[model samples]
Target: MPKALLTIESLVKNYGGGAVLNGIDLTVYEGEVLVILGPSGCGKSTLLRCINALEPIQAGTISLNGEPIRRDSKDLPRLRQKVGMVFQSYELFPHLSVLDNITLSPRKAQRRPRQEAEAEALALLDRVGLKDRAGDYPRQLSGGQKQRVAIVRALIMHPEVLLFDEVTAALDPEMVREVLDVILDLARQGRTMLIVTHEMQFARAVADRVVLLDEGRIVEEAPPEEFFDHPKTERAQRFLNTLTFETVKKKAKNQ
Candidate 1:
């Protein structure tokens, strides 16, 4: 069996008396690409936020390598570094260049030398096909380029796990492939990742496992092939049926 890297048990998150996450239990194994599939307002993004310690949980626990993660803990800053997150919004500093944005945390938080951090940032930029855009500000790049820079920023931290929350959702249809391709490459490299996305084809291609959520609870969990082709639960079946592939294809062709 693969070793469990991040574990969430009986996780409950409440906002103004209503539960956003209703007792979620999930275990992300080492080198696994786990894709979260659910309709909007199903708390998919909230779960990722809770794991990264960006939100407080009302009940249960989240652990990394057997160590519990608490929101109010003094070690939260350090613990958060172990779980890198890239949001839908690029979240890059507008005034900073791509290289600066990627190197900021490494130099300030990890205290790495300037020369070493820049070298690593440049190498990562090159890997994402953005080396030539290093000196450009976030606003100067296309949506896909900004997202790639955000991914590089997260990667420079060398996190044990990566959390991607609809990183391609805000991009143009033509640009979506670029961002998704970068994520697919990461999966090919055996990086442990938790991705929440609506791109069904990309999910099937990149995920080792697929998790279906409804009303903040896991409806089904299975390998990508099985989940996409042979979902056992009725909830899973309904969810899959709702995705109109023909319509999407027609729309794509029109674009």
Candidate 2:
């Protein structure tokens, strides 16, 4: 059996006396793309945040590469450097140029020399097809370009695992494809990824496994074809039926 890169055991998170993640358990293998699909407010994003210690879990444990991400751990910074996150909003530093945004974390967290960091950042920018936009500021780029820069920024950190939180959610219809293409490319390269997305087709195309979450619990976990074609639970079936591939295909075609 392959060693799991990330493990969550009996995880729980609550806000205002209500549970967002209720006794959840999951494991992500190395070099696998695991896509979490669910309705809004089902705690998928919160689950991703908890994995990286961005959100405080109310109960249970999250371990990355066998090391638990405890709140008080002095090595949390080092842990974070190995876990890259790309958000929906493409949180670029407005004051920094694209190249600077990509290099900043490596320089500060890894203590890399400026020239070495810039070289790595530029290589990452090239990988994301944004090599020409190195000197551009965030305000000057389109939403897709900005998101690509965000991906490049995260990649420059040399993370062992990447977390994508509804990365295409904030994109326009046309822009969504560009971002998804980048993700698909990474998936092909065998990057370990945990993605929360509503793009079922993209999930079907690239995910090694699809996990359906409802009310903070996993309703179903299966390969994409099986999960879409033969959902094991009523909730899963309902969700799948609601997302007809024909409808989504037509919408994409029109866009």
Alpha-carbon TM-score of each model against the true structure: 0.95, 0.95
Error of 1 at 21 (Å): 0.5
135-240: candidate 2 lDDT, tens digit per residue: 9999999999999999988888889899999999999999999999999999989999999999988999989999999999998999999998888889998898
Positional deviation of residue 161's Cα in model 1 after best superposition, in angstroms: 0.3
Off by over 4 Å in 2: 245-255
- Over 110-188, each residue of candidate 1 has an lDDT whose tens digit, in order, gives 9999999999999999999999999999989999999999999999999999999999999999999999999999999
Q: Give me the displacement of residue 160 in model 2, in angstroms.
A: 1.0
Question: Scored by Cα lDDT, where does model 2 land?
Answer: 0.92
Against the reference, the lDDT scores of all candidates come to 0.95, 0.92
Q: Clashes per prediction? A: 0, 0
Candidate with the greatest TM-score versus the true structure: 1
Indicate the worst ten consecutive residues by lDDT in candidate 1. 241-250
